[model samples]
Target: MIIEIAAQGGFGGITAASLRKTIDVSDQPERMRQDLCDAFEPDQLARLASRPCTNCADRMTYRITVTEDRGTHSFTLREAQIPPEMLDLIDQM
Candidate 1:
């Protein structure tokens, strides 16, 4: 699996300084993958993707993309909207 996280947009219609990171999980052990999957919680991600925020001000917007053997999924969230589990996942990477 490969993951990419990016930050874009901000208050006053000013584009925030871009930030991004990419992570590759293909070489991880099965156990590690399972743990990551559990923490990532695809169901939660799906729900987040389904209800994207339409407006944001004075805040950085985040876009997280994950690609795996099955397929790819992406989610857009504000800095304040990032889940703790997702934050942990990012820290691990």
Candidate 2:
């Protein structure tokens, strides 16, 4: 069953049960979230560190830095209204 959550942070909070036993990369929201986080966290951390004097936590800008991977590249992200999809595995409260 595909799940979507409104309260949990990040790509929402996806529970294990919301996914099928067989893995499918194209249709899995949870897997997409994990993959996105895996690919983006390092860059996000780097962007956060460049602003030392800025303390406006409510809104901030990302610092773009270029570095060599296979070649030189630059990337950045902005604080936005990305929606999080949440999942619930158990009904116990």
Number of the predicted model whose lDDT against the real structure is largest: 1
Clashing pairs in 1: 11-58
Evaluate residue 67 in candidate 2 and report its C-alpha lDDT on the 0 to 100 scale: 30
Q: Model 1: runs farther than 4 Å from truth?
A: 27-35, 50-55
User: Where is model 2 more than 4 Å wrong at Cα?
Assistant: 1-37, 41-58, 81-93
* Each prediction's whole-model lDDT (CA): 0.70, 0.31
Local accuracy of candidate 1 as per-residue lDDT tens digits, 1-93: 677888776568877567788866666787767766665555666676667565546787778887877788787777556667766666676
TM-score of each: 0.65, 0.22
Per-prediction count of colliding residue pairs? 1, 2
Cα displacement (Å) at residue 83, model 1: 1.9
Candidate 2 residue-wise lDDT, 17-63, digit = tens: 22112222335477564553343344543544444543333432233
lDDT of 1 at 56: 48
Query: Candidate 1's error at 15, in angstroms?
Result: 2.2
Q: Candidate 1, after superposition: displacement of residue 69 in Å?
A: 2.1
